[model samples]
Target: MMLAGYLVAVLAGLFAVVAIYAMLSSLPNAPDYFSVVGVSPIAALLVPPLGMFIYFLTIVLTGMQTLVFALIAEFFSLRNALLHMMFGAIAAVAGFALIWPGASENPERWADMGIIGTAGVVAGLVYWLIAGRDAGFRRPLFERA
Candidate 1:
């Protein structure tokens, strides 16, 4: 599972980087580094498609990450990895929500970035409630030395 996670993350990150590079190269009259940081209507127009593309890619990556992490935790016979992955996913979603508040508030928005946090929470909670016990819910037999 760890191997799977590693592979998926590397692949997805690589693809995202390539897409970003392509988008940057295709821009007309690209701004200087500092200028890129400032908000402009024109810039927003240029960014939406790329942002949507990246966000979709990120969602895929998160799904892959969650699956790989869960598999790893199961293979290692440890329950904590599930929690870690769940919380990590939630954090990622929250970060996106903060960055795209309008999307977060509006379900019909294009990217639906705002609901990521909520989805993460629901997924994690549901998984925990349903399959957590089988994945090592029992108390430890003895304290580690």
Candidate 2:
């Protein structure tokens, strides 16, 4: 269930990135969309969501392992938003690094790295917003609570 929520949030972020890219690519001065986007928009629209599922699954598994280790050492604590932000930063760097080698081959594609990194950060933030809150965190429906 949590994964579903995270998936929705990430997909929404990805859509926003694609929409922005599409708009920017249409500008007369903009570089070719294929070079900037690194893939056809059709593929761009389809690939990340699928890739993210795998990527996020890896994150979850690694987090679980870390949690288990922390628990064994009595160092575990409730989830923190700052920690989520840290994860977001890490994801952004990792995403950018993964594409850097290929992007370096073409000067035009270098600009796309920024766009891809931005998208990664957005996806991370969306995931954090959807799922990073601690169990004790709550919001009241009325202001007078």
Candidate 3:
């Protein structure tokens, strides 16, 4: 259960963060795409390529953060939504910092970071919804399944 939950939680976080990042990054009026039938499909079409690119970057940049946080949670038995959210935001921001080679040249660097951090929070919430709430629970070895 723990392994399954962990995998689902991580995947959920990854997808949420990437989807949100893609939506906000590519869409001019992102909110309109949320419900309008005409544009929603178009926006959906944009996600896959961007998602793959961002997914790879996220895995490379934030992988350590994710692993460290998961380890900390496992050892400390952390199940707090806030902690997960914090971890997600930190990981995302850290990833952004790690990836941007010319941060000084980019005028909108902070804006991108803000978007990513917000998405990370949402992702963390999604993770918590699926798995984080029961973090670090260990059944007794002798207990019957």
Best candidate (score: lDDT): 3
Error of 3 at 70 (Å): 0.7
lDDT of 1: 0.48
lDDT of 3 at 56: 60
Inter-residue clash pairs, candidate 1: 104-114
lDDT of 2 by residue, 1-145 (tens): 2455345545654555576687777778787653464344466348878666645653553344333322422233335655554454455445555646576677776666566556655655565566555222344467663
Where model 1 places Cα greater than 4 Å from the true spot, the runs are: 1-62, 80-114, 136-145
**What Cα-based lDDT does every candidate model obtain?**
0.48, 0.52, 0.66
Task: Give, for candidate 1, the lowest lDDT window spanning 10 residues.
Answer: 33-42
User: Per-prediction TM-score, please?
Assistant: 0.32, 0.51, 0.63
Using TM-score as the measure, the top candidate is 3
Ranking by TM-score: 3, 2, 1
Sorted on lDDT, best first, the list reads 3, 2, 1
Q: Which prediction has more favorable lDDT, 1 or 3?
A: 3
Q: What is the Å distance of residue 87 in model 3 from its true position?
A: 0.4
